[model samples]
Target: MRILTVVGARPQFVKAAAISRAVTAHDQSKGDLEDVIVHTGQHYDESMSRSFFDGLGIPEPRHNLGIGSTTHGRQTGLMMNALEDIIDLESPDVVVVHGDTNSTLAGALVATKRNLPLVHVEAGLRSFDRTMPEEVNRVLTDHVSDLLCCPSSTAVDNLEAEGIVDGVHLVGDVMYDVLLDDLATLDSMASPVDSLAVDPPYVVATIHRASTTDDPKRFDDIVHALTQVATTIAPVVWPVHPRTSDLVGGLTVPDSLHLIDPVSYHEMLLLVRGARTVVTDSGGLQKEAYWLETPCVTVRDTTEWTETIDAGWNSLTGTDPDRIFEAVDNSSAPETHPPLYGDGHSAGRIVELVRSLPH
Candidate 1:
């Protein structure tokens, strides 16, 4: 069986590595699986894009559509066209997509229209807010997917509530798999701080999502909070996301805040591992910080990964200066917690499930 895998953003690229390794390893043993990777190029920055594959050891994509940024509808439409064209040519038995990016929604639509079976990794995640584009994408993609591979039992219950009874499997999180595999290599690499000129005992900050940084007022508020908090002993090491940097052009940064370009996944892992604390709006980073045993302050009102919150490792500060400062001041070292996302064998379990499926 051949699977067409689509990845468009940095997080998706990271998760895809697990699935890719699963397919490759399974094929090596069972000799019946083939995989093709397609890059939507939604995040086309050199460090953000190419470095992910290199850091994670994922194979190069078979096709790079090179569809950069645009309005939501336009970007999804362009991706649909490109993916449909590729599907027509490759005619794979299954099309696997990860997460709820525009790319995932586009790929699901294309595959469903073509009557190809669809598999959604990290499926059934719901913020229960229809206003969020990602929530809409998740709901739509889950509705269409032939196989829903979920990370947590909460996600499976979510699918059940939505009446998706069949083809729902709790196979844990692929990110956990990637996290386990990359941690060793990341530990071997030199710290990004030495190269980027950022000092240790720093708080790592990352802001990218539209809801957090798109609005000028909200962006300004976050920046102001960072400035206020910079007076503390430790500095802030912020590897700015390309999108957020563009939105906050020419904004003055506090001297204590070291703003650098986005680092590679391994570099990011190292930074997170060594950080005194992490403050971010990234969902992935929240979980990653938990895994790295770092205290995390999320600059958002809500998070899908409430496991981190329940474990006392993460706090939602919601872009409020007082909350941000308080959270930072009160942050504590993360105690080692059991994997809420699951044990680090999700990829292997998924591979076994795929192999057991009737052809």
Candidate 2:
């Protein structure tokens, strides 16, 4: 069995790493499975892309479609056009997509159009906000996927509510599978936060989501709120995204708000694991913080990972200064964090399910 995996962003690489490792083990034992990685190059920077591949030991992609920064329609359209040809050339048993990036949407459209079976990891997630592009991508991808690998029972319930019962499996989170493996190596790796010179009980922040940073006014407000958190609550260490870095370079940021270049995948997980509180709009970070038992103050109003919120490990504070400060001030993770994502074995299950697909 051959699986063509599509990935274009940092988070997808993390999730794909788990599946790739599972495929390697499967090939060793079963000797009948091949996994082809196709990187859309949505995040082409070395920090965002290459570092993840190197850190996670993901095999070099079979195809790196250099679809860099662009308008959404152009990015996804270009990916679809290029993927159609790749699909025809490879003719794999199935095309697998991860998360809700433009690349995921593009891969799903091309695979379905080419009459190929599609597998969507991280499916059945919904913030119910149509205005967000990710929400649209997730909804559409879930609808078309031949197999929907859900990370939690909540996600499964989401799919059932959408009347999407066929081929849905509770395979847990592939990211959690990777996270568990990566956490073990944290002791060997030099802490990514060590260079920042911040002490313990410091906040770790990543605020590069478009909803929070695209608009000049909103971005300024969020930066201001972060400044306040740093001033009164605790120092903040931010691994700045390239796009967000450009915007922040012009702003008057505080000394307490330490900004640094993006770190590798394992380095990031280490930082999150040790953080006193996490502040971000990134969906994956929210879950990582919950798994690490770190209190998270999400800058977004709504989150698809509602399980974290219900578990009392995450708080939403929508970029408002008072709310942000308040959430940060009161951020305290619950003593008991029930098993949310999985048992760190989703990759094997995902590969097994993919193997079951008819060619």
**Estimated TM-score for each candidate:** 0.95, 0.98
Clashes of 1: 0
- Where is the poorest 10-residue window by lDDT in model 1? 350-359
Q: Model 1 misses residue 322 by how many Å? A: 1.5
How does each model score on lDDT? 0.86, 0.89
lDDT, candidate 1, 1-359, per-residue tens: 88899999999988889988888888888888888999999878876787888878888999999999998899999999999889888879888899989999999999899988888999888777787888899999999998899999999999999999899999899998989977778767898788757776788889998887778777778887777667674788888899887765687777788888889988888889988889898878988998889999999888788778888999988888888888988889755676688888898887776666555
**1-359, model 2: which lDDT tens digit per residue?**
88999999889999889999999998998899989999999878865687888888988899999989899999999999999889888888899999999999999999999889999999999999999999999999999999999999989999999999999999899989988887778878877767877887899989877777788887877788889989888898888887698887776768988888888878778888888999999999999888888999998889999999998999888878889889988988788889998899999999999988988
Q: After the best TM-score superposition of candidate 1, give how far the Cα of residue 257 lies from its true spot, in angstroms.
A: 0.6
RMSD of 1: 1.6
Regions more than 4 Å wrong, model 2: none
CA RMSD per model (angstroms): 1.6, 1.0
Kindly give the stretch of ten consecutive residues in candidate 2 with the minimal lDDT sum.
43-52
Query: Considering every candidate listed, which one attains the maximal TM-score?
Result: 2
